[model samples]
Target: MIVGVVSDTHDDQEAVAKAARLLLEQGAELVLHLGDIVAPFTLRRFSREGVKRLIAVYGNNCGERLGLLRTAESLGYEIHDWPHVVELAGRRIVMVHGKGPAGETRELVEALARSGRYDAVLYGHTHEVDVRRVGSTLVLNPGEACGCLTGRRTAAILDTETMEARVLEL
Candidate 1:
């Protein structure tokens, strides 16, 4: 399965729509967002624009900007409060906002890797697109949809079967 990964949207409706549209056009079957959408409608917009099977986790800014659990539930989106884990297409995916200690976070992810529990760990908060393999697991951060401050908007596409990731500039 090919899944589109994105993060730190920060309310750029246009960019979000464009990214969703493009990914859909590219034949992405699912969309996974790491953090910082800043509004519930962003996900709705992506769904409206053509993305199916949307999954997301919250950012530090999500409390006030995004919908509550019930709202997200109604929208057919699984909104992870924080530190969530899900399995898809035979690959285990763990997602967090990555706001705490990088060393500890990496250690925890590495531990998970040791268990062969996941295929990837996705995070957002640094606004940097990164993909690396930690032993058998892939650690990824799609980073900053509109470049909030850095002007570097990007997204990632992961092929679950191949465990390959492709980064795209929006």
Candidate 2:
């Protein structure tokens, strides 16, 4: 299965639209938003035809949690707290928003990747793209889709069959 990973959208409608299109073009059947979605309208941009499921976790910046949750439910999507875990394509995956100080978040992400409990750990918050393997697990942060920081809007495509992923500029 092809899974699309995005993080820190920060309410950029255009970037989110482009990213959604790009992910569908890349044959992504599932889409995961790590966090910083910000608004319900911006979150709706990810509701595309090709994506079978959309799951998101709460970021520190997500103040309108109730609205976001309502919208997600209306769209048949899911909104969860941070560090949510699920099995997909026969692999255990943990998703988090990467809250806390920058260094601490990075350390936590790496720790989760190295803990040997999950096949993949997805996170965002630093607004920096990180895709690497820690031991046997895949750890990825698709960067900031809003392009507010780093001036680069990015997303990621993960191929579950091969356990490979790539960050793409959007």
Candidate 3:
């Protein structure tokens, strides 16, 4: 299964649409947003046709929490809580915004990735794209989808079968 990973989309509608289009074109069955989605309208980009699911978590900047939830509910989507765990294609994929106590440190994140607790640890906060391996787990961050801080908008496509991640620049 090919899953799309996105994060830190600080309400850049164009960037979000672009990333979603690319991911859908690339045959992404499911799309996961790591957070910082800002507004509910921005979340609509992930609801593109052909995408099976659009799941998200709140980031530090998601001020309109109620509106966000309402928008998602109206759209038949789900916004999970932090450190959301999802099973895709038989892989234990963990999604988080990389905030709070569980993901504040690189060491802690690495430890979680290497703890044999999950197959993939997906997060975003630093606005940098990274794909690394710790023990048997895959640690992936799709960077800033809005390019707000990094000046480079990006996302990633992860293949559950091979555990390979391909970063996409938008």
User: How many residue pairs clash in all the candidates, one count each?
Assistant: 0, 0, 0
Task: Score candidate 1 by TM-score against the native.
Answer: 0.88
Q: Which RMSD values do the candidates have, in order?
A: 2.2, 1.2, 2.1
Off by over 4 Å in 2: 48-52
lDDT of 1 by residue, 1-170 (tens): 98888988877998898789777876788888887777777777787887767888888777654364555677777788767887888888888776665565556656765677778888777787778888888888876887776788888888989988888888
C-alpha lDDT of all candidate models, in order: 0.78, 0.90, 0.85
- For each candidate in turn, the TM-score is 0.88, 0.96, 0.92
Q: Name the top TM-score candidate.
A: 2
Q: Candidate 2 lDDT, tens digit per residue, 43-119?
A: 67777434458999999999999999999998889999989997889999999997778898999998899899999
- Over 4 Å off, model 3: 48-52, 100-105
Look at candidate 1 and tell me the lDDT of residue 95.
83
Give the lowest summed-lDDT range of ten residues in model 2.
43-52
State residue 125's C-alpha deviation in candidate 1, in Å: 1.2
Model 3, 72-99: lDDT tens per residue?
Answer: 8878778877788999889998888876
| Residue pairs in clash, model 1 | none
